[model samples]
Target: MPGDGPRRGDAFEHDIQVGALRPAFEAAGLELVEIDWRAPLDDFEGLSLVLLGTAWDYQDHPREFVTRLEELGERGIIVCNPPPVVRWNAEKRYLRELERRGVAIVPTVWLDDAGHGDVAAAMNQFGTDRVVVKRQVGAGGLRQHSFSRDAMPDQDWRMGRPCMVQPFLPSVVEEGEYTFLFIDGEFSHGVLKRAAQGEYRIQSLYGGYETDFTPSAEDLAGAKAVVAALPFDDLLYCRIDMARLHSGELAVMEAEAIEPYLYPEQGPGLGERLAKAIVARL
Candidate 1:
């Protein structure tokens, strides 16, 4: 696992996942090593599999980080989900492609420093009373905000960073968020994430809670289609996050291909299943 460092006190999820995965890999005759994701690229040599685990710093310098991984891929190193997958998934614009392919996705508008003026126009088209403005490339609910149509911040807010504007779906408050965990394109488990009392972001860092959830046949089928549409042929694992729209339709919120938190706390054998998947790929 390539992360910041050894798990700390508040990082219980990180500890549990790394701890469980380490023993599972050992029992299967594979040696598991934990490295800092921000370590120099030179350290990756001789490593068989590079799991792009957590390193918030990498997300901030994604282009450089992914470039290094791509170089490693050229030498036949196996990077879970792969570098191309990471490059594509890192940008929020991928949502547009999914929508064009006939997948249901939350309506989104992209804004760079040059496109700040378009925010109002785009939000008007989505026809929502409130919209969410978030950095185009971010994780864990960092730098995300909700704003009413009449209360957008000044253009200075978009001066140095690219942002995405999406209409706030009221259904998030009513039906909670659903995340489907898949290993090698097959269903493993699902979870329902409820945000803290009045917040809309469902990240645990933001006081959200997740519980094992069973999806309806329709929800399961929809989630499957979203994953199947991705271009990866050897995707080791992924988490597909979704939320209901005002029209009672499921829409893709995010496709977490890099270091998504797999809620193994929900079941006893989930970690074992994931280890088996990794072994099959090896």
Candidate 2:
């Protein structure tokens, strides 16, 4: 697996899945080595596969990251989730494409370049007083911010870049978001993630907590449709996160195919299942 090496301030250096997944790979008769993605790849000559375990810092240097991934592809190294899937999922605009294919997505108004006036326009377009704005390419809730039409607009989240704005769904606070885990298009497990009290972000790094969840039939149907609507179907793994809106319908919060945190706690031996799925892909 290609991952980030220990750094003094690297937030994902302590990812537990790296260690947790080692045994599964071994059991599958494959050798697993965690290599620093930024380091030289001279030692990976015999490596059969490269799975992105926790290269969370890819967003820090997206151009270089994509370049390296392309280089690996040119060298005939197998990359899980595929390069097209990574390129598409790395940006949030994929939600719009999903919506076009009849997948229910949280209502969004994309801005090529957002300004204070654009934020106001987005609120009007969304027909809501409050909206959430986030950069097109980001993780860990970075650059995500909420703005209220009643209060001063905080366009800082845009950071003078392309952004997408959506209505703030109260469901995120009222009831947690549901995440459906899939390996090779097969559903494996589900988890419910809730933000800390008085918070809106549901990432564990932000004090959010995840718990095992049993999806209702409606939720399962919705999640399945979302996955089916993906542009590509041979993804090694995917995590579809959805929230129940006030309208009593589920809206996709994200259909992450690239490096989503697979909550192994929800399903014991999930890494084994993932390892097997990856091996089958090869």
- Which candidate tops lDDT? 2
Query: Tens-digit lDDT track for model 1 on 234-264?
Result: 7888899999987777899998887787777
The prediction achieving the highest TM-score against the true structure is 2
Q: For model 2, how does the per-residue alpha-carbon lDDT over 124-213 read when each residue is reduced to its tens digit?
A: 887788888888888778777887866746556344777888889989988989999998888989999999998988887678888899
Error of 1 at 266 (Å): 2.5
Mark the 10 consecutive residues where model 1 has the least summed lDDT.
1-10
Q: How many residue pairs clash in each candidate at the backbone level?
A: 0, 0
> Which portions of model 1 show Cα errors greater than 4 Å?
1-10, 114-117
Per-residue error for 179 in candidate 2, Å, reads 0.6
TM-score of 2: 0.92
